[model samples]
Target: MEELICMDRSQRLFEDSRKVLVGGVNSPVRAMKPYPFFVERAEGCRLYDADGRSYIDYCLGYGPLILGHANPAVVDAVAAQLEKGTLYGAPTELEIDFARKIAKHVPSAEMVRFVNTGTEATMGAIRLARGVTGKNRFVKFEGAFHGAHDYVLVKAGSGATTQGVPNSAGIPADTTKNTILAPFNDEEAIERIVEEEDDLACIILEPIIGNIGCVMPKPGYLRFLRKITKEHEVLLIFDEVITGFRLGLGGAQGYYGVKPDITTLGKILGGGLPIGCIASTRDVMEHMAPVGEVYQAGTFNGNPLSMTAGLAAIGELERPGVYEALEKTGGYMRKGLRDISEDLGIDTRVYGVASMYQMYFTGEEVTDYQSALRADKELFLRYQQELLKKGVFLPPSQYECNFISTAHREEDIERTLVEMESALRTVL
Candidate 1:
C-alpha cells in the first residue's frame, strides 16, 4: 500500500474544532487518539477524507447508512421534501404513509408513533410500558444500549461501554432505582430477577447485542424471554434501533420469530436521516397522549424529509434479492477475515448475521458483555488503526459492530479483505 497520505487539513480542523466543539467531537466515539478524519464527501461505499484520501467505510455512519452514504434515491427523496417544508409540527399524509409501511413490515407494529431520535423512541416505549402495566421497574441487559435517556442509561453500551462507563455520572441514583440490569442471553438469571422484583414494567433489550461487538443471543434465549415476559404479564420491548431494517425488513423480531409487546426503531429507518419510532399493539399504544394520560410528543416528529427519505430507502431494501446480495457480501468478507487470521496464526473469531459482523482477538466465544471484554482490545485497536492507514475504515471502538451496506460491492469487499490481511499481519 502507498504511504498513508498526510491528514494535515484534518489535523488542523480537529485542533480548530476543539476550541468550539466538545472534546473536538460532537459524539464521543468520533474522538480518536490523535484526531478523527474529517470527511470531504461520501457516496456509495466510499468516503473521501479532508486530505483527499479515500477509504471503504465499514462503520457506515454507526450503522445508519444502510444503503451507504449519498444513495441517489434517498438523496432525491430528501431533496424533494426540501422543496416542500422541513417541519410543520402537524400531521401529513407522509407520516401516515411511513407509519403504514412500518406497521406492514414489522409484525409487532400494530400502531406506530414517530420521534426525532432513538432516545425518544425508547423513552416513549418504556413510559408506555410503565403506564400500561401500572408498574415502576424495567429490566435491560448490561450492555444493550437503548439510548441516552435516564431510564435505559444504566449499563448502556456503544460509547458508554467502549469508554468503560456503562453508568453515566449525571443521572440521579434515585431516578435509576427502578431500572434493573440483567445479563444478555442468560434467561435463568433474568427469570430469577423478574420473579423477585415487584411492579416490573417490562424487559427491554437488543435481540442481538450490537454494542458489545454484535453478541448474538444463544439459541432459544429470545423465545425464552418472550415466554417468560408473557407469563409474568410484563411488557417485552425490543430496542431494535440498531437491528431494525438492518437485520431485514422485519428486523430481529421477524428474523428470530419471537415477537415483543413493544419495539423501538431508528438508524436506518430514516434512511440515514434522523428519525425514530415506537411501535406496539393498539391497546399498549393507546396509552400515549391525546387518547390516554401518558404524554410523549416531539415538534419534529414525522417530519417530511425523514419520511420521504425513509420511504425511498425501504423501497430500495424491498427490491428483489437485495438481502441475498447483502448476505453474500458479508459471507465473502467473513471468509476472507477467517482465512487471514488462520494464515497469520492469530487467535480470532468472527460471527454475525446478515450484513453485520464482529471480530474479537480471542478464540473463545463471546456470549455476553463480560466475555466480550476479555478479548484483546489493544490488538483489535491496532488492527483498526492499520486498516485506516490502508484506506479502509472500521468502527473506531472494538466494542462496536462493523456494518455492511447495500452499496458495498464485490470489489469493495475484495479490496477490504486484502487490506485486512495486510493490517492483520502488522498487528499480529
Candidate 2:
C-alpha cells in the first residue's frame, strides 16, 4: 500500500497539537504550510514519521546532525553521561574539556562563554561589544540572522530576516533604533556606515551567510569587512552558528582565511543539543564579569548532558576524512541538482561552501541578501512540497540552506536527484 490516507493521520496530529502549542509548534520554522510531519524516530539519513512514512532527511535538524541521527557514538556518550547526571546547575570537567576542544579546533576561539542557543550567543556578543566599546549603535547585513534577540533582529536573516523587516511582533521600535542594516557583500555600504555612524560598536555577519539561503561573500568581501572594522576600531563578530565546524574545522573564518575579532558558535558544537559560544582575545573576553565588570551568567549555561554530547560530537568530527567526505558528498549532490535544473530548463543558481548549499531559482548570482531575494518563492514552495511528497525532505522554506552530513552516501545523493527530477518535472 502507498499509505494513501497517511496525510489524514498527520493532519489530525497537527490539528490536536495546535490547541496546546503556539502556531502548533515550538518554533516558527517548524510551522510549514499543509502541516509538518511529526517524526517518530530517525536513524542515519532517514526519518520515520508518526504515520509510519520513511523519509530521506535533508533538513538534518537544520544543520546540526552531521554525524547523523542516533549515531552509536553519540548515543553511547549520552547514555554514559546519564549515569553521572543531567543538569548540575553548576560547572563540570566536561564543560572545560569541551571548551578546550573548541579552542583547539576553531582558530579564533581563544576564550569561550557558553549559552543555551545561537540566539543567546549573538545577543550576548552585541551586549558585550557595547559594554567594551561604550557605544550603542551596531551594524548587521540585510539577510544574516544572528538570532531572535531584539538588537540584531533587523533585516533579520533566516525566517524573520527572510520575509523582511526586523522583528515579527515581540520587539519594540526602540530595540532596533541603534541597529543599522546594510546589504551583504557590499564593501562600500559598510565603509560608508562606519564613516557615518561613528558610534558603531560592532559589525557582525555570517561568513558564509547560511540563513539568506547559503550565500557566500563576494570575492574579498569578508576581508574588506575585517579591514573596515579594524580601521574603525569596531569589533568584527562572525556569527558562525550554522557554519561552525560544518564548513571546516575552524569554520568560515578558517575556510575563508579571514579572521574576525569575535566569533559566535553553535549547531555542530553541541552535537544536535542546545549550546552556543562567543569567543575573542583574552583582553576583550576579560571584560566579562569575574575577569572585569561586564556581567553575564546562566543557571543551565553548561549543562552536562549537552556538554557530553558536544564533547563526543566534536571528537568524532575530528576523525580524518570527516569533512572531506562531507564536501565530496555535497559536491556530488550540488552537481546533480544543477544538472537536473538545467535539463528541466528551470533557471537556477546553486551557491555554497563545503557541506552547506542553497538552490536559488534564478539565473542571476546571489552574492548577498538582495540578490538572494530575487529567487522565485512560488517555485521554491511548489518544489519543496513536491519533494516532501516524493519522500525527500528539504528545508521547508526557500530561505534556509540544505545541509549535508557525513552519514549521507553517494546512493543518498543519487536518490535525492531521482526524487528531485520527478519534483522538477511536476513543478516545471
Candidate 3:
C-alpha cells in the first residue's frame, strides 16, 4: 500500500479560504473531499504543493499548459513584454503579428478577435453567428461546454457537471429556450433540429468532447455535420478551447478535415495566460464590431502581454517533432493505463486523442454525455485519490480530461504508469 502524503498546510489554508472564498475554491472541480492541495510552485510536468511534496502532473492546468508549467519560452516573452507594458488600451503591432500566426495555423481563422477568456470567445462567437445569420436559435451538444454564459450553459459539462448543476439557476427559461440541446455524435438529432428549426443560427460543439472526458466523434461524423449545416443554411461553430493548439497548429478543424464558419479558442492559445479568440472567414468575422452590426469589446482584448506569450508559445510548437513527441507520449500513457487496468481486472474505458485522454470506470463505451454519466464516478475518485498518495495527480473528477505536455519525459510516463497500476489495484 502507498503511504498517504501529508497535506496539513493545504488543509489549514483551505479552512481559512472557506471563510472568504466560495466553497474554499475558485472553481468547483478544484474542490476535493478532504480539501485540495494548495500548490506552492510548479515547473515542467510537476506540481509542488504547500507541504513541499511534488507529483507528476497530468492535469496540466486543466489543458492550458501544453508546454507544461513555467515554460522558459513563455516566461521570457511575458517578462520582456512586462518591461514594455502589460496593457495599453490601444492597438499594438503584436496583435497583428499574433493574429497573423493564428490565421496561418488555424483552418477557420481568416480574421480574428481577441478576448480575455473562453467565456467571452464563445459568447461573442454565438452573437456573431446570430447577427450574420439573422437567427436567434442555436444548437449545442448536451455535454459540450462552450462557456459559462447563459446561452450555452444548458446541459453544460466541466465544473457544471462536476457540481451536479448542469443548468444554472440564474439563467431564465426564456434565455435557454433558444439554446437547443443535442447529443454528441447523434446525426439524426441534428438532422431533425436543422430541418425543423429553420431559424437556427448555428450548431456549436467541441469536435472532440473534452469537458466530459475526451469523447470523440464517430467516423465521418464531422464531415456529416459540415455537409448538413451548409445545406440547411446554418453555421457550424467549433469550440476548440481545450483542443486548439494542443491537438495541433490547425486544431480539430484541420485535424479532422472539416472547416467551421466560426471557431472559439482559448487554453493553449494563451500560453498559460488569460486569453481567448474568435476566428473565422473574413466574410463571417466582418460581422463583429466597428465593421458590422454585432458589438463586442474588452479592455484586455488584445493585451500585448498575452500576444507576446502566445507568439513565443506558438513558435516553440512550430519546432520540428514537438507535436509528434506529445502524441507519442500520450499514446504511451493511455496504453499503459489500459494495460494496468486489464491486469487488475477492472472494468474501464480509456478514451483520448493526441495529448488529451481520460479513463472512465465503466465497462461500456463512453461516446456521449449519457454513456459518460454511467461511469463509476465514485470509484474513479477513489483511484484519483490513491494516485495522489503515490505522487501521481490526475484531475479530481472523471468528467474532466487529463492532458500530456512536451515537458513530460519518458521517465515521468513510466513512473506514472507504475503508480497508476498500484492505485488501480488498491482502489478496485
TM-score of each: 0.97, 0.97, 0.98
User: What global local distance difference test value does model 3 have?
Assistant: 0.92
TM-score of 2: 0.97
Model 3 per-residue lDDT tens digits across residues 155-239: 8999899889999999889988998999999999998998899789999999999999889999999999999999999999999
Q: What is the model-wide C-alpha lDDT for candidate 1?
A: 0.90
What does the lDDT come to for candidate 2? 0.86
Q: Show where candidate 1 strays beyond 4 Å.
A: 1-7
Residues 298-403 of candidate 2: C-alpha lDDT, one tens digit per residue:
8878899889889888889899989989899999988988998888888999887688888989989888778878889779989999999989998887789989
lDDT of 1 by residue, 179-273 (tens): 88887888789889889987899999999989989899999999999999888889999999999998789999999999999999999999988
Candidate 1's displacement at residue 244, Å, is 0.5
Which order, best to worst by lDDT?
Answer: 3, 1, 2
* List of clashing residue pairs for candidate 1: none
How far residue 274's Cα lies from its native spot in candidate 2, in Å, is 0.4
**Stretch of 10 with least lDDT, candidate 1:** 1-10
- Which wins on TM-score, candidate 2 or candidate 3? 3
